[model samples]
Target chain A: MKETWKELPIGCIIEEGGTSRKFKTGDWRSERAIFSKEKCTNCLLCYIYCPDDSIIMKNDKVVGIDYDFCKGCGICAKICKAKAIEMKPER
Target chain B: MPMKALTGNEAMAEAMRQINPDVVAAYPITPATEVVQLFANFVADGRVDTEFVAVESEHSALSACIGAAAAGGRVMTSTSSQGLALMHEMLYIAAALRLPIVICGINRSLSAPINIHCDHSDTMGSRESGWMHIFAEESQEAYDSIFQAIKIAERAYLPMIVSTDGFIISHCMQRIDMLEDKEVQDFIGECKPHHSLLLTDKPYTVGPLSLQDYYFEHKRQEIEAMMQVAPIIDEVGKEFGDKFGRHYGLFEEYKLDDADNIIMAAGSAAGTAKVAVDEARDKGIKAGLLRIRVMRPFPYKQIQKVLKDKMIISVLDRSDSMSTMGGPLFIETRAALYDTETHPPICDYIYGLGGREIDVENILSVFEKGEIYKKKGVEKKLAFIGVRE
Candidate 1:
């Protein structure tokens, strides 16, 4: 990006809020969270523990993880009681 | 225009009554307290619809003003001496945030001896706080500058400090040609903030943490905005003059044409110096006076033009800079004249500090010294006038 005052925002006033969603932090992750539907007990503990709200649910049933917004912090794997979620190194 | 005798503080309160800002968050300080007090009385009497917040301290007063201004409301406040000192940190924040908050700073001396008298030290100390500083010579100018300040502040999107010498002008009563409420309201119009916090449709953050990435750019933008102030002031002054028949400029030149020696000063002392200049003119000494109405943005080019032809000039500063060189106005005037082709011998005089009485004779003595300096070159760059030693 060109570093000049004209390129900068006027008065540094950010026009939008909650814009962090546009930045996919998943690129920063070395490992990604994988979900096993069969081994899952729909306790929603991982949903409550996920920092990035990456846990996905379908029809009120625990489905899989949304990696678009997830940073793969392994919080879901650490919080899962049924070991339904696993942390695997990204290929 | 209706004429009424009023003190400087009363005149400011009357202006507030006419403008009737949305929010006035202020604390009570000597000389300036009367301004807020009278406005508060107006608030009590239902004369104006304003949320008058009696803040705990000057810091909270300015903080509340910032919040109100950020929320897209017309905001104002008043302070003096130590009170202004207390609002120092928030002053920078308000200016950096670019909130058009109009502040009435009754100029008083800062502490150490703890004086409550008239001086320019209070506002002079905040020169670089990124606020436009306008000094008023009398109650009439003080009253009128408030209205002009509101328009200037809104147009420039920068904060403004309208100052009157404490007790000298603030407490002294004078006949002020007052404007009608309808005229003032129409002239000032409504407060249309550029970026308000209350704009839910376009959510934005104020006072955000920029760090090193964008802080410098934001400050650069602020400097660019400040550079527009001189022209904006001229435009607003002309509009005001056309409407009300009172013209203003960056500074006021009194009989400067064809004058050999000139005295440069600001605030109420300028009024006293003008009388001395007239006396000198009558005696054919060719003395003139230049009162700097606007201090910040310094008016470098305009001042250099006015002083370029003069042979001798003495800048009287009511406040000391403690810089060992000279006072604030002296330093600024010297710097302004540095690039000019005509090198007039300019001297600095530290005078009228701590509300010390400076009569016509005191000013006349300064002019006499300027004459002597013009003939036999200045031995000292700076001298103290009205001091015991």
Candidate 2:
């Protein structure tokens, strides 16, 4: 029920920017990242290193993990020096 | 119309001067060098208001042209042989982006031995580049096709390259009738890019990274656009003819009516075929020539209609596909006639590679073979002319 090839624009020009938000890459996660706020230093290293910007932030403080865009890359978990994030296999 | 003698490059340069596009970005190469050089002189003399960019390489020349075209400017350029080979990569980008950039190309042999005379190898090599190709027989046709090319490219939103045979047509002096500058300007009018980088207030990604998700869809759009070219070519050619007394079509049929034998060709080879047909007709033999003008959007339907009733036909190709079967034109022509109920036995005569001379004698021999093909049947489907062991 998606748009057919006939409905696409001429040339591969993406007319609207940020249309990438429509495709949720969370389905690509074989393993998911789990964040621990209690042991967190709140250094924002995970927030800075997360490729998908899935590290949730509320008023300059680390909140939780946003599963929608995260692909379980674990870059945020690896970059977290405070051991505030960990990757767990998905069911 | 004013009559004057000019070489193929001169004629094309004159057309470019009249079109006077917004930008002219080009690197000079043999045969096609005169075209851009003359245009540069036009620029120097202040004859036209165009941003002339003399790039270092043919690749850069086409790259600059693509950028200028994307920036909502009418762009033009010239190149031949290795220059065209170098621009091969950028050629597809221009057409895929739906940029209406017109290129004046002189057909020359590609290098290995580096023989630079005349052949269809340059344009034929780039056959799948997705650009509209209009092959002219002579200087007049080359000159006339240039104006039509600009209009066709802009109208169809596809880049178009009009070619003249190197040395044979490009250097040969011939009489051509010229349209007044005002008339040509009025005819083509202007170039209005469909989706331009500069003609927008909203931000739109021009050439985004298209992969598995939407690549096919985008390519399908380009294919659909090419499907729309045949009619536009007819309309533009007709309009040019109507206003200037010179008509155009997808392919020009010379003495095809009631002819038992037909010779299909393009470029300067077609020019020689005309004389061969005339000579054959004088001897009470029915010989005809079908000069293909448009190669891309290959006029299969139109060609099928004309070739349906012929007794036998031969496609004279200037470039060998090196596939061990036949030449490029030969393969395509045979494919086009696949479903015809009265299809004549089609054969191919691969000739004139590396600018070999295909004289009237060479063409007449092909016609002589057609008579035997009509009776006995075609044994040799492919033959090379003027090539030594």
Point to the candidate with the largest DockQ.
2
Runs of candidate 1 exceeding 4 Å displacement = A1-3, A7-9, A19-91
lDDT of 2 at B44: 97
**Judged by TM-score, which candidate is best?**
2
- State the lDDT of candidate 2 residue by residue for B203-255, as single tens digits: 56777777787788888899999999999999999999999888999999999
Deviating ranges (above 4 Å) for candidate 2: A17-91
Q: Give the TM-score of candidate 2.
A: 0.88
For each model in turn, which proportion of the native inter-chain contacts is also found?
Answer: 0.54, 0.80
Clashing pairs in 1: none
- Number of colliding residue pairs in model 1: 0
In order, what DockQ does each candidate have? 0.39, 0.49
> Residue A70's C-alpha lDDT in candidate 1?
78
